[model samples]
Target: MSAAPELRRNSLDLPEAVEAARAQYAARRPRSAALHAGALEVLAGGNTRTVIAYEPFPAAMVRGEDCRLWDLDDHAYLDLCGEYTAGLFGHSEPRIHDALHAVLRRGINFASVGPGEEKLARLICGRFPSIERVRFTNSGTEANLMALTAARAFTGRAKIMAFRGGYHGGVLTFPITGASLATLPLPFVMADYNDNDSAAAVARANAADLAVILVEPMQGSGGCIPARPDFLATLRALADETGAVLIFDEVMTSRHSAGGVQARLGITPDMTTLGKYIAGGMSFGAFGGRADIMALFGGKLPHAGTFNNNVLSMAAGGVAMGEIFTAEVAEALYQRGEALRARLNAVGAAAGVPLSFTGIGSMLTAQFRIPAPDRPYVPTPGEEQLRELFFFDMLEAGIYLARRGMVALSLPVADADLDRFVAAVADFAENRAELLRADGVTG
Candidate 1:
């Protein structure tokens, strides 16, 4: 019952590692320090996204091209974070850049349908048979809003069922019940992910009021847990039995396959929401499903946004999707992702870190296990310390992955980039874990 062996490498010593990482960051961004000081004067958290803010301060990135990003102080690093999987086509990809530039010249928001909308919509529907019609939005959050509205309209019910740890964009009503969104309530009921029986039981119990069951085919924010196929099939059956809309939020998983997780699984949901890679990093989202369900927006339910299908996003999304999504391209991404996952597993095993990964194609997550059952899987008092150490270590090592340990591979990422990432993991295993142990985070 003594403290278990250290899980990571010597690089993760809590107190020492945090200080070292901050020192390294300060060394690289003298300008960023000044910028943060100035930003804090105006910005509430000195940053827009709360998650991106970290101790000391977050570096302000000035430019990004392809797989690399540069800070205000001119520090360049490989961008493995990809804006949290939104940049699947890479930063400022040529096709997207060109399309965006051209479209911007014409206009940005017309608040009217443009030619690009029809083209992009056609592409989205063509890939996923379940998406017979679609409505565009500016971000994933808006897409979920529309999807939920449609579900409520179609089912004539009030409650939505979401899997625990499943993320369907930030809807205050839906509140992220599982991993992060454990606060809010849509008259929501949480069921264990990858556990179909529990989920089915919840649906049965809540059948009368369940409007829809929203899930991520692969949970990106919730530790990148893959939704078990059987669980999805069972959920589909339950939804059908209870007359609830089955909505799969494929924002993170769309890059994996043309039609997304629904298409990859060869199962159709009554509705689907897509974002992230859809616009090739410029910011776009869409919700589509059966024609009748989607058509609810036309008159029955209201779904309107002046910038929903802005010309630039549509143009960039159309060009990027057309170029990147093909049988050959998808297969190549699959193979590359498998290689990356295998390398990470090897690193974890050697480091004595119980790391597990689940996903298909380019999207994946690395879950670091803690000895405490409620540690990694459920948030414990010390969980924040462990996560902070892991991220600080990884960031110091020059691999810019999320603190939560999610990785999104771009089609542009080649052998060298992949090798660099794997090597970083190995270094962490060999050097970072000791740092974590020294911080009193052992086991």
Candidate 2:
């Protein structure tokens, strides 16, 4: 199906819009500004995650519940960022909170496996057909590291291939340098996302040394782009041809479905790395795949971590996956996401804006394009300019859009909230032409 119809472009004034956004934000978040100034003395840029850092100051979060968050400055927002897509059940969910209390009271950690670990593991394997056995880690990054290590051990190969835009999170350890980042280790060979020929060429060239091919079913950090059906099938074929293990890093995309993008796409990886929503807004991660490959860690390879299956994380995750997140809930998210996409496209069409929106299940992104009548190309920086403009303007309109073009939809984001989000996008579409003009990107 096509996106909504197009709209006419509005004349914009660049400098004025930038100044307006700056002044408006500075006034609304005075507490954050003051805190940022004080924090600069001790912490670099007064924040933690680089992604959260923005122009002026970062909005420090004070508290969160369900889908709403209150920033340090006492400003409340409908949290679309969702802790960078980690708080899947929304923040401080009741099911997980209650489970945590019970688990913590019983004990925090034991050197041996907890029964809750098996329950969570079973939940994961039951959802995804490929994962015969699973192992827990503390984060997605660690889970990926484990997957890569296990893949190499099983195949007896040294090199690994990953996609250019795909992120598997341990480039430094594998010496897999990211195309977008300057970090090192630098051993990974890159393939383009959604391109079958490009992936085939990489597989052919590295056929001998390649131990694994790690990919994200949908590239989250690269921009919420889904892998084409042909691309996934091609990779799986290549893995079979080259005798390389195929791994899907489903950290961000796991919330989209019970089995994640792999199942939704109807492709299975040999191994999978999962995190984010698994712990119900807490820190946790796990990786699993074919039983033969995953069992290497127990006696064949030997890997250990102090908190691999920490009792509390296991307990909370078991409850979240077992009871809180249901097939009905996931389907609800997909429906809501579809509505949001349609609304955004409609506004873009009415405004003559090249509003191209695409997403699978619950994840979505809308990119603005220049004034081409049909099939308009995304603006030179793709949609970055519009993303920045919308980010600032939406905040003024009282919406908390992440600096990125994405908004993670939580279960609590109801009809009213969706209305507000759609209205904000329309406001941006009407005003962005002017905002860009003011910023000096004139025709």
Candidate 3:
């Protein structure tokens, strides 16, 4: 009858511990601090990418080799962030590195259809189940934009259905805080993720005006939460009934399998947008689907980008898909990730830490939350403090995690490294027991 300890609204009283960690972090990275100070003169808030920035200044990584990174302060860390899931092949993948060199020797930008484009396109079309025909783009943001455009053109509808906490790209974010002003100016009906009835109701309400229902098979930026099979099935059925385009934004989840999450889930969307490691760690993006819808792009609605088919991305992407990340290797990597996640969860259970990791395959995000038997998972208030404390603690232990507590595995990460990371988490739970326990976190 009493309030659940984990659900009580108590202030996270860890200022002293947090300050100590911050002090240690600052003392270890004076050079990085100075770099950020100087960068403030030019770059906005000493940051070009918003996600990489953190308080007490972000560590300036000097170089990376395989699964390791060294900061300007000479601190070495196992690169668990994996460039936020984009560094799947790791920093120094030999094949992709050599392929980029070959591309440079041949030409930087031919400004015309290059030989590698077809090769890369062929590989993508073959690997992704939904991509019957594909087109290149400079980034995933552009790819999503193009896919939505194609949908609106084909369906002649102006509205889009997106989920709260879903991040398609910089301009396509739909956080629980609400869509930002920078988000593309379109009529977007927001729905809760993994809530089938909410999604179905939203789709029904907008069935007449819905152009596309855009979703991530696993919501990457929304804490790596995988969609329930029934939820995806509901969307598929809704799209079928309404004749709206269903687009899966697999920019991060595509690395889950050779055929991506769509193939694994036994669901095929009308379109798929891809990026991240598909280009072998190079900058790249792609969108493709039923040939009938895509045919409208060049003929009915003009689509062009100067670097759409750049030689470097095309060549590296081709080698990445065809030579390195074959179906067999992808399956093996996925199995490794599944095992690692299980181990991590086991460690959390043993330590009595209220830690939950949500993800599939090589992608994951750690969250601090109270378990609810009758409701969906919702993060606890002041959980960010726990996350930041964990981040600094993990860094001190020589594991580089995202500030937001995301950890992604790369092909080059060894089993020993994963074991070490798990050990580090256990150590964190022990060391921060008082603070965590006071916050009502329990196994």
Question: Which digits, one per residue and each the tens of the lDDT, describe model 3 over residues 1-443?
Answer: 11122222233357656667788789879999999999999998899999999999999999999999999999899999998888999999888889999888877967788779999999999988899899999899999999999999999999899998889999999877765877988889988888888988999998899999999988887788888888899999989988899999999999888999899999999999999888998889999999999999768989889999988898899899999999999998889988887887777667776766778888887766534111224455557778888888888889998998888899999989988988888877666666666664444
Q: Model 2 — TM-score against the truth?
A: 0.90
Give the Cα error of residue 409 in candidate 1, in Å: 1.3
TM-score result, candidate 1? 0.90
Q: Which candidate is the best by TM-score?
A: 3
- Candidate 2 residue 270 Cα shift, in angstroms, is 0.4
Q: lDDT of each prediction vs. the true structure?
A: 0.73, 0.75, 0.85
When 2 and 3 are scored with lDDT, the better candidate is 3
Q: Where does model 3 exceed 4 Å of error?
A: 1-12, 370-378, 440-443
Model 2: CA > 4 A from native:
1-12, 170-186, 370-383, 434-443
22-116 in candidate 1: lDDT tens per residue?
Answer: 67667767898998999999999888787577778887888878888878876677888878888777776777788878887887768677788
> How much is the lDDT of residue 321 in candidate 1?
75
Candidate 2 lDDT, 95-159, residue by residue in tens: 78899899878877678877988999999999876799998899998899888899999999988
Per lDDT, the best of the predicted structures is 3
Question: When superposed on Cα atoms, how far off is each prediction in RMSD?
Answer: 4.5, 4.9, 4.8
